[model samples]
Target chain A: MSQVNWRTINVDALDPDSALNFDMSTLTPAVTPVSASEVQGLAGQIRQLLRGGDHEGALRGALESVPYGADEKGKEIHLHTVIEILQSIRQSEMSPLLSRIYQSEGGSELLDVLMKYLYKGMSHTTPTGGAKQMAPQATGFSQIHPLRTGDGGGQAMSVFLSWHEKLVEIAGPGSIVRVMCDRRTV
Target chain B: MAQPEIHHLFHRPIADHSFSSDRQTLAVARDNLIEIYGKSGQKFALQDELRGHDKTVTGVDIAPNSGRIVTCSQDRNAYVWEPSSSGWKPTLVLLRINRAATCVRWCPSESKFAVGSGARVIAVCYFEEENDWWVSKHLKKPIRSTITSVAWHPNSVLLAAGSTDGHARVFSSFIKGVDERPAPSVWGERLPFNTVCGEYLNSTAGWVHGCEFSPSGDALAFVSHDSSITVVYPTGPDMEPKAVLSVATQLLPFMGLIWTSENEIIAAGYDCAAYRLRGDEQGWQLAGSVESAGRPGMDSHREESALNMFKQMDLKGKVQDDTKLKTVHQNTITTIRSYAGSPERVRQFSTSGVDGRVVIWSV
Candidate 1:
């Protein structure tokens, strides 16, 4: 009934300012449905969980999120937040993030869960396999290099690329694709 | 607590949506078609479809005073629809460009509209009475990449465009004939059509997702892909700005935002819920979200007993399901606009997203 002032007060958050290295533990992650405040707040912890070989736990950390509502739309937002995390992995922190997940045991299953959610997230409203068709159709996405197990040859991305291959298998060979925001690289 | 009214339009992604001045009609860009919905008693019913664009329709907007709808699509075309006695008539605007048109909006005066495009230009379109058709002039000097979003000042002459080049710029779109030469504000006096008033960028050089001019047109706020929102207060056109404040948030990046007042802004995007940010030139801070999370209908709903938990596990193979977001929108919120309000204060706002749901929230 009452209005709360939601303006976040983080001084010097702009460019060419003194960086604020605030503590992450200073704010706790809410177990209840996540609002905007809890999204990137757990990036470090989720990465740590992935490195610890807790694939399911890391997957839970991502997909195990709860929305603020019981409605179907609320459910979609929850899954959307999960997709945001996956996109961050694919776009920004691919090597470090994916290597941790791929090196861990049952890491392929985590990829499968991601593939499933990718389908669910895009297919929530439409019958299209969403990510199923996109993954294979989008040629711009990075290709899965020949994977090596021992000594982890070449870039740490070898592990990452292997998981992407496994994702293609789960979502069907032709379904792996990428959707980008409004930008023109070509 | 208040319940947000949600209209589930269809299955495919809703790139953008708009409402007529009377709030009796709605138009949404589904794929290549603009589906218009007419309000019955309480729900919106399908009325007609505008089929023209060959590719996906990206944005749709209706002028409040003129009652005309402007639509832009990935097919690199923009159309203006005028309501006629029989139905809506579509007139093609000459947006001489190559890339996709990303976003479009009518100026407050209803005399013109601007379309942001992937061709790294903002096409300012208006009617050329001599030619009896709409004509556009390109704003093409400083932009390096695609223009993601564009907003108009209350005066309807100054335009704010956010681009993939990681800059939000204020340009004076003063057309010699279409606009009136009025009092000069902090932006500048003797403003030319392409005068670059001010330019600001985010901390990490993130793509500027949304840009908006405050009610008084004295301040500008923009959200970037780095999960940060920055507000700029320009003292003059050439002088050093009075203040450029940025709020780095822990949330996901925001897609679009709107000014409810000079001091309050409602922004929603990948987070799916609309958040309230209130502040002034002195300072700014996020108040919270407009919607409550995870707790609505807590007591009235069926109790989650041990039996319910087991039943969920048996059916879905999971105890805690992440299929639903606690927010009203299911996916990324593509646009947020003031539903009912004057330039100074907004009473309600609406949001449409990838989940294909349009939600109106009262403030």
Candidate 2:
């Protein structure tokens, strides 16, 4: 089984701009910009990897791409990704966008990857760590800044920043950075 | 698809009629008197006026196998009445309650019956052969809040009570000497839901107005102050909530809720409208809407207008109190219940409101 070419999986190819159009106000413990993009890209890659017959690699890729951030949008994206993956696996469908991959023998493998990553990410990034702890005092703001109490508290923050850099590294800093900067106002 | 044929066995202008277990007789509480009507809608002629209840009787229930009838009144007394050759008369009266009695129902198969009072306490009375009428077990705790409605589990072991505090509590009776366990007392355990299941907060401040357990005993349907209905399952030891369905802005508080089947629910509200909801739908569909024809105030208003036209003919000072008449239909709805015999039939049910006339609807 061939591994997914992470570099070729551009942020534009995944259509991050359109995907972010949904109202993110209701998202709990907001998500970070980089983390959101990575999640979007991972969704696309998982679709391609499943279509390409690299089930093991797709699973491994999903496991590696964990959501890390306190932002409500980020947490919502994480939850949506997990739900999407589970639903796809349950219905034996490929990711939402790439229908061509759905017809291939690699579809099952792609589903496996989405499932692996979703459960792994969920356990690692349970909502209890962040805004949940400060929820009483922060009121509505707690959803935007989920603060982890213990040691590894900085892990999600660093992962979020790195995830954004990876998108800029793969899909031209000019296009990706401009989009990320615009999302702050949205 | 063909519509189910509904047979209307009887129709009367009686205001508030409650059914007995056999569905053969109905006990109608009107004005200050309680009348029993046969299935054919004929007055049983056994008219017994319960005088001790200084106010209108709000609810009545009949025991399953026994001939005893329990009636609750605004006067704050739950009276047990038994039928004799002369007429139906109140034999025992339990007094000194905090609020008016709102609902009363017999335990499915037990010798006991339950009463929900305005005070939020549910009193369980067990029948004793030696005492003649039922007596209160007086379990250490009265149900914790002001109960608006009470339903007995079909099998008779559990009682589901809905309160004014927006919570539903399930009380179960345990065997007294089945094991080394202590004898089961009157008041059972209580369970409260963390959040009301089907309510959509319009202004973030609302309480549950009504709730009923389904006939199958598998689900509990509740209506919230926000005009939304919630269906919950009370099967497991944990009492897990399975689904929450909200009906937006259409209905308001003080509505009636009843199950048409295991999955379908029907509700009516103060808007003079009724709606039916299936499990798969996002909200309730308007089933029917009707204005009461005999609204007491409207009748009195018409009478006053007619009297003025006659140039105040010489007669006794029988002018009705306009304020008292106006208070009759404060809420559009007066009373509601499932069709007497068939619990699953959806097309027909019974209701009475400010009109003071009971109307039965089909389709």
Candidate 3:
């Protein structure tokens, strides 16, 4: 050809800025990846604590072993254990339990972990188990009834929202922002 | 506390600023041009402007000793300005990257400078005597995202970089000819080029916005987008750190931070105020805001009557003047540099912000 038509060529198409071109695996810190089995082991211990009526111990246990590097299944298991611990606490004991945890050593960090789980639990749309069934009702009505149970999703959402409200009262709005901006999966 | 010395520059963001070693010349990256201000009497007057880049100037630094002004911009280029009898002359550096350069810093030795870019690379550039111009050696491995900021170790061989990938890394930028063999330290001994000395990720995986080595170079501290500052103290080479303290704050995320002393850090960002964090290896906490609690414009003593409303509306074209923030900066402070005193004990520091003001604060 005498001359190539440069104007006809698309620049972006020729040099695409595709995400696949960049390898992000090496960018993370060299923390040992928390395996799924390790998460299971921690869940078992948390369950034992929960069965013994040690809700605080179970919550602490769950919060302490947050699998930040583990897969989705591990995170889901930890979230379930944490929800169980939160649900067992009496409504009147919520503030007292929070204050107690907040005062303990490394308590703020534990609360931060719990805040992460609360956010995870709230964003979870697909229900896990069939312990409680929720009717398809208006969003406003569902929020009005925190204890009312129907389906797993709605009740879990209400629980998460209730804890979030109380969490803000104690931890302030910064906790939510931290959880949102934090990129660690768990 | 003495009142902060404030210079209201033109109404534009100062992305980066540097003061000459003698504290007479001030170079600030104002939008697309580098505006040079000379200290005269008590105030800084506009002296000259260096214009070369076609895009926003992202970073600027004047070598403390050499007085060479190095500037990088979004146009994917960097310039080293040298002062001659005629004026300042610019020499374009060969930063063969395809993306915008975000930040730059002159090494303590003033022999080499590091330019962090959006292309996931840090170009450590130095002058090549053979070529008689500046050339760059790219640190391309292990960086996955835009490099937000870079800091040079006191030794001038080890470089600390903060990136959007949420990891703050220490790399040995030991150019064989440009840098001498640094003495053995906690970081490492045999530091060839591109040696990964240390990498610390933000606990919450927030994008690292700022990174700085301690005055002693034994510790590294970085501020992330999660509104937390994490300090890393390495024990030895190829070993776990002695302590990695992450201090979460309730205020907004800090865009820049500087180690005032070994145990103290001053950080400022979207909160429009400088906060002092104090602690040692024991623990770190948000000590307090550097700005005193109650200032003149902090109180909202507006008369809620129609007369006052009409007066305010007539004077300012608004019913209420809620625009002024209680803080001195009134906008996000982007960069905080050690202005005076040694790194061991910074007696004074300067902060530049989007509000087009450079404030010199005494510690």
Candidate 4:
């Protein structure tokens, strides 16, 4: 007889008025809505830190003030800044920097937030609204961020995947489970 | 410390097991049937098999005072087996849920039992005297996913349920006729059926696998898929809990946990070894592995001949024996129950794992 994975079975497919159809919005904790200007201001500071080769500061700045309550445009701006910092760090410095971050207070939680952003960065495709809303272009910042394009996105994916690998290596799979189950969306 | 008693029952996984008050009879959920074993000497002999459910049995609990065995299965059915001269008579319970039952636990009073189901409902069943059949009342509200485990409070009125939705909720399963009025407590003043007393979510929101009320029934502790166990102490009704201490472990997520006392908890899961966690509402931390590093029954004084050492180095390229794990259990431990002593202070506990072995360890 073929073995069945009972726990993963979708019982709701059989019952129409199933209790599983819960309102997901209520499950997540409500957050104070962040304005677009706040997200843009943070992004500007993180970019300046990145330009000065303070990758650690840039990473911390990007992760600490997550735009969990930000609007779509604000979140997109923050995501671009986060992905840029994630890619700018040298491969050799990755482990050392992660160790420092992990040892800090609330280190594990910070890593969890990073893991969530990594997941979002990987699946994030081109947004529905076009680049018409693009803020005043920063001079040195890349015109086309890899994750926002229909093509040449594999580079961005590999970067996020590698960071994910290093993260799980240090923080263990608990971080992944935390990011996956946490309802405090970012 | 005494060596843990290891019993290799069978190759099949034992999802749940329960021992009688006398510790003479043991019932284990083996595949689709419930196997009852009678202890004769040190080993248990197969005495009987209660075969009814067509699906895998998820849980089984024997009421301490009554010696009645309650079993729930993934087939969406529950049966109460009563001891009789003819044999064990099985009475089917009307759960009235569309999904499979995940867990069941007999209340301390043994008057009623709660069955948690994938239907996202807990069916608190009690015997209706007029009909002479077991019937249930559904607690349906706020639960968002499959119920993973259910535990009865010492008062038998408050029920704690852990679910895949990352919430461990406490509810009042107070059946009007079957239960007497419970005294006012921190949970609430007037208890009514389906009253949600407490709902807790860990910081990580991992799927809660096991939950239990503290020995005094004043606090709740739950193990979640994030490899953390959180202990919640309620301050009062409609008030913030005094404290919720979450101790995160680097090990694999715990599948089951049992509080040995007010301050100590023994938890085991995919890590294959039970770990002791020590703390209280003030603070909590993972103490260490319950079992020592040395694997039991190994011949520590085995003489290693010169030729044997060379052979070992040649064949495996290393003389050290690294094949077996330091822990006794070789696979994930699915269930851990207090084997001896009261729930207030357990002296010994028994754990059954997917490795097909049940080991009783002293605390």
Candidate 5:
């Protein structure tokens, strides 16, 4: 019961006889998804810094703004704030945020730094069985980041799903299986 | 409240968990068997395993006073386990349902048990003294979908069932011979078997995951897939409820909920945390999460070697923080049962989850 992604389920796939026939549309109304403009406004400075080719500067702001060391409640609000920014910005605008963080000096490190907030933030918001594990095959960074063409990050969950997908995609094809095999011995 | 006791028993998801009346014994339904654990000084050690069902055991309940364990499974069967001098004796129950049995609960009187099934029916089983066997009487009426949960009212005759059909309905399981005449209440006056006392569909028509009766059994609280908890206070049978307070939240939907008092409810699900909901016949609202402290490892900046950092970077293209959740239960909490207190004034409750953890927390 906890294994499948209930949200990702296509509504038409529901079997009348099965227990999974939960109408997911009930979720859509509560999702006051951070509006695109609000997201743009929240991430305005970071957007400007990235567009101006100051990748390092944008990465710094992304990393510095997070209250990683804050207490539980403070961290939750801050994470939501960061998530709001991520969820708000359009993929056209957000893709650059990812690309810049990856392209800059120690950009990979910055991506990792940024990912910490994303990961921790998601854990905070999602309910127990509600959290979904993105398929391992989809865990490729290149396919995930979409570099220029952003397709999957349209929904709220895509933000978390895109993380590992981009990770494996960046490593190219066999790296996931290879690296896992290497880690097994180490 | 002292710290919660964490028992990481195994890797398998715990379908359901129950503590003995004395709190010295624990029963957990795993894949196909119900594992019984004896609580030692502070931890539960595996004492015995009851194996009878061929398929996954979906639900298990321990009758407080009878010391009998009732378990139902995907194999379309239910078993009553009685502790004997040797170990435990298993008595087969004739559910007669074709599809998988989803959940089961013993009535407060412990004389009867109800098994909800995918066959679109609830099998109310009781011991037929003449036959000397557990026999079931089907409550098949307006149920449209698989039953996910069933909560027995304090009176034992009123049963609340939440189903995938997005409805939580109240029914009369009154057996003429077995059950005593229940006093007239807001639920109904004339009660008969399979009587639909009240029927409620989720406001958003989402699948109802959990349904529970208040301590007084006058109110019902259910959590649905819409990430909302609704409290229903009945006015009278076959009439509009006095209040149907639906408290919606932004978190993911809850898997199960329990009423601690007439005005207090605690629900836990996919969010992996239990949240408190408080209200009355007037209005109800989400109080907040029961646990506030975030996941561990997120708080501390542990120093690691440069080599370690490089290895993480080399392997995953980032320094991943793959640590367990900060909450007591690291995964989805499937069921939260009252542990240390009575229904009205519960002092502590226990939650078992997909992570195979049984955590007892103070209320």
Candidate 6:
């Protein structure tokens, strides 16, 4: 028999005085607002914990303070932040955290969401042909590199990720992540 | 994975099967007898028994152009037999070798055939003066070790020989003049890393058991005692190691290696597993694994062993007892030959050990 455990978000664990705080406004359909000063404070605290090599503690704090199973947009932002923090974890010993995420209920769905957002962010923005003559440009964000074209480099990177995802799918979330992390350390 | 379906074509134990160039008829060697069978499994009855070799025949080959058959045996004589209305009879017997003739291979054009013996020398014989075949030239420079396997390139006039000395050498046709049979000249050599068990050098110089040339004639594949298959190519300008596929854990002391196609190589070892290594794959894959059909009287012997040691109080009981050994059909697969005419035919050819059983596998 197989078992699954869904991890719960503990947003109350965040210290009120920390330098980095989770901004409530960036979350779509904002319900509450946290001052920029508070987010800066929380970020500082995270940096200090990382420098002190308290990786596990820092990761736990970040995961606990994130809102999960919220509105779709808000959930997306929260999950994105969690992915960024997990990626930043330096020590290979932090594999247990990844394993816990993989084994959690709805783990596959969460990973799917993460992959969709990552792929969308890497896609190129095309030029608009005739969109109401752009009555009033909201914010101009020009394409960065004109020479960056074609799918060769991006497709190669995607192929590698696809292979990794397929392995994870075959191994299941929990044990596969733990094994991969352990192998990385070795 | 599902196991392959095994069909029994012939119940009588056969030693080996050499298909005619057209693959319409099969030349089978069983014990001291040789029989030809048609494609329909009907005994051609063309020959009851070819009376030439005294000992059990070890290997057999059929000329590509002519339908002449060659059989080698522990009798230390390689006989060339021609089919006639009455029966198959020996046309010529090359009797100059000291050790048992292990393998015989006829060139593609059927003009010449090479025979290897335990004597470490490869003798090339040619069919000269109608109906008579004689040794045109021979390499007496005995390979530093016993020559266990020999194969001719598909099209080119070249021969590849593998020896127990952990090396496979390629030789070019040295036939000087049409009248003056010439000796073969050494072209190149390929040496693979020693076996992992560290017995590469000390192991008997007869470890090289199998050798074959790819259909393209650009590469040669061979196996050693270490259970590793090495592929060597001499056409590349730089002579780089083209490909090396290891069956280290699957195949041990492979006795037969043959190319099923340009990209697939099939090899069978002492173990019952038949392995296939794809051209693009990094390692050999298990194509077929077969356990012995059954062992007769094996259960009773084990029970007796325990009784003899405990209740019987027989202190003189031999620990390595050979008398109670089970007579199972686990003969080492000696040779594997693909169908020459139908490349994708269902039945592939193979030969075995003491029983001299010839098996046709449906692929």
DockQ of each: 0.02, 0.01, 0.38, 0.32, 0.03, 0.01
Worst 10 residues of 2 chain A by lDDT: A177-186
Question: Given candidate 4, what's the lDDT at residue A159?
Answer: 82
Give the Å error, residue B253, model 6: 3.1
List TM-score (chain A only) for every prediction. Answer: 0.32, 0.28, 0.73, 0.73, 0.41, 0.34
| TM-score of candidate 6 on Cα atoms, chains taken together | 0.50
* Candidate 2 Cα deviation (angstroms), residue B72: 1.2
lDDT of 6 at B51: 70
Model 4 residue B26 lDDT score: 89
**By TM-score, who's the top model here?**
4
Off by over 4 Å in 4: A1-17, A35-37, A71-73, A90-93, A118-166, B292-325
Q: Model 4 Cα displacement at B328 (Å)?
A: 2.3
lDDT of every model, 2 decimals = 0.73, 0.49, 0.85, 0.86, 0.75, 0.52
Report RMSD for candidate 4: 7.1
Question: What's the candidate order when arranged by decreasing lDDT?
Answer: 4, 3, 5, 1, 6, 2
Compare the candidates by DockQ and give the number of the best one: 3
DockQ ranking, high to low: 3, 4, 5, 1, 2, 6
- The residue ranges of model 2 lying beyond 4 angstroms of the native Cα positions read A1-186, B1-16, B20-25, B37-48, B64-67, B93-98, B138-144, B173-205, B280-331, B345-347
Per-residue C-alpha lDDT of model 3 across residues B16-41, encoded as one tens digit per residue: 99999999999999989999999999
> Residues B196-233, candidate 1, lDDT per residue (tens digit)?
99988754456789999999999999998766789999
All candidates: interface RMSD:
13.9, 20.3, 2.2, 2.2, 17.0, 24.4
Cα RMSD (angstroms) for every candidate in the order listed: 17.2, 20.6, 5.7, 7.1, 14.1, 25.7
Where does candidate 5 chain A have its weakest 10-residue lDDT segment? A177-186
Model 5 over residues B195-255: C-alpha lDDT tens digits?
Answer: 9998886444667889999999898888887666888889998799988887656466788
Identify the CAPRI category of the predicted complex in candidate 5: incorrect
lDDT tens digits by residue: candidate 2, B1-363: 222122222333233556566656767766555666565453233334545567777777666577788887777777888777776667665544667777777776656677777654566666555756556543213233467677766655566666544455555643232112222222223322111222212111224556777776656666655445666653345443444444333234445677777667667656544456666323333343333323334454545676574544445344444334332233355456775445655555665555444445542
Residue B163, model 3: Cα distance from true site in angstroms? 1.6
Task: List ranges where model 5 is wrong by over 4 Å.
Answer: A1-186, B293-320
lDDT of 4 at B202: 86
